[model samples]
Target: MANKRTPAASENDRLYGRALAVIRMRQGIPQQRAAERLGVTTQAWQNYEAGLRKSIFTVDGLSRLATALDVDPGLIEQVKGLLKEGVSEAWMSDGAQPLPTSGSEGKVVFFSRRAEPEVPPAEELAPVYGAVFAGKPGAIAFTPDRPDDWKPVHPNQRGYRDPFYLQVHGDSLSPRFEPGELAPAVRGVWPTRGQVCIIETHDGAMLLKYYERRDAQSVWVRELQPEPREFGVHLADIRAVHAVVGGAVS
Candidate 1:
């Protein structure tokens, strides 16, 4: 939950900002551009910052404000009643955060912090044996919020599910999948022939290849489409060829 701050209507918590945000977001209007339409300078519009405080405007101004905001004129009256009566903006909002963030292609945005999947609660997991050294086995439990620069358990390989995400680094496997693409190779389910499958060999090599298990003895991997005389078949124990991603939508 976020911190909630409600100001009296007479106070300078500057509820104007919230009003401005609502006005801009509700009407789908840009800031400076909306200011121009309202015949107010940009800085003057900035002074109407909404999140900080409660505010009041002239009845006539409120009428024009409602028109520009594309909201009911009575909304101003409602704001007055709620702000004066000490109701939090969040309360009237019906439990949604009021923050403006950016989206792809200059779209309005919101931030989300979702919890991890399949992780057991502290009560569900076994208790810790002891606070051991960093080098000790089983020293570190599940840490979902890993630091950005921290390397995974495997430097060259990746696992898609159950403690794995493939962060592709070098360009050796480029042309089909680009470098730096987080092409996570999960274990558990392998795809049918000619689909993207993250495979691990018996020799401890991890690879992203389109798989074709022609028979039980042969595995044909085509990272890139083949040309003439390109013998793409490699015979090996597939060890694990779990999970295909990005090849199909459903």
Candidate 2:
């Protein structure tokens, strides 16, 4: 289903976009830099500035943007007022005002954190390297890629380094991650406690497990389904550990 936008909704989008653009430009914050700091894609940041999306109309979005741009909290209030109450005094004090909306103005969109995100187009799909065992010990060998091995990339993994997908093997992480689902992982990132990770060992063994902790000697990991258990893999035996951002059914 498509997201339908009313005339008022469209106007609100533009109004919020222009006001954010003004503050962002005044602060000399580059869109890419702001997006990187906010942990969003550059295109997502541009959408916020152009008012194409209402993802930034909430308190958390604004707070994060403020931190990214180093803008004062008062400016956030001014922007909110311009959108909600129309023609804020802060804008008037500067002898300029944001474009006025129609009398039948639509309320601003303040999406909850649980709001669904826009889907990525087919062109943005990542490749699935091979399978990683989520239950038993498995080899780290990657099979040859077929013509249809592509999978969707998560929004948060957009700027991650060397992103690739791996088909999950076994049901150890079931009810959350399952067999045959594609797991997106990135290189050069150390997995922290509570995160699922794709771990490669020195002996060509691959594991898909919850990261627990690590010390100079070994890294601890866990599994949930069938039974809950934790174990440690020696750091010297691990070749690489990449965080699994999320899983997608293939």
Instruction: Name the best candidate (by lDDT).
Output: 2
- Alpha carbon lDDT at 216, candidate 1: 28
* Residue range 61-90, candidate 2, lDDT tens digits: 766676665443445555645555555434
Residues 135-237, candidate 1: write the lDDT tens digits.
Answer: 1112222222442332233211211223244444333345545544444333444344445555555644555566644332455555442331212334465
Residue 184 displacement in candidate 2 (angstroms):
1.6
Runs off by more than 4 Å, candidate 2: 1-116, 143-148
Q: How do the predictions measure up, each by TM-score?
A: 0.31, 0.50
How many clashing pairs in candidate 1? 14
Model 1, position 66: C-alpha lDDT score:
55
Best-fitting candidate, scored by TM-score: 2
Q: Local distance difference test, per candidate?
A: 0.42, 0.65
List the candidate 1 regions with Cα displacement exceeding 4 Å: 1-163, 170-175, 225-236, 247-250
Clash count in backbone of candidate 2: 0
RMSD for each of the candidates: 21.7, 17.3
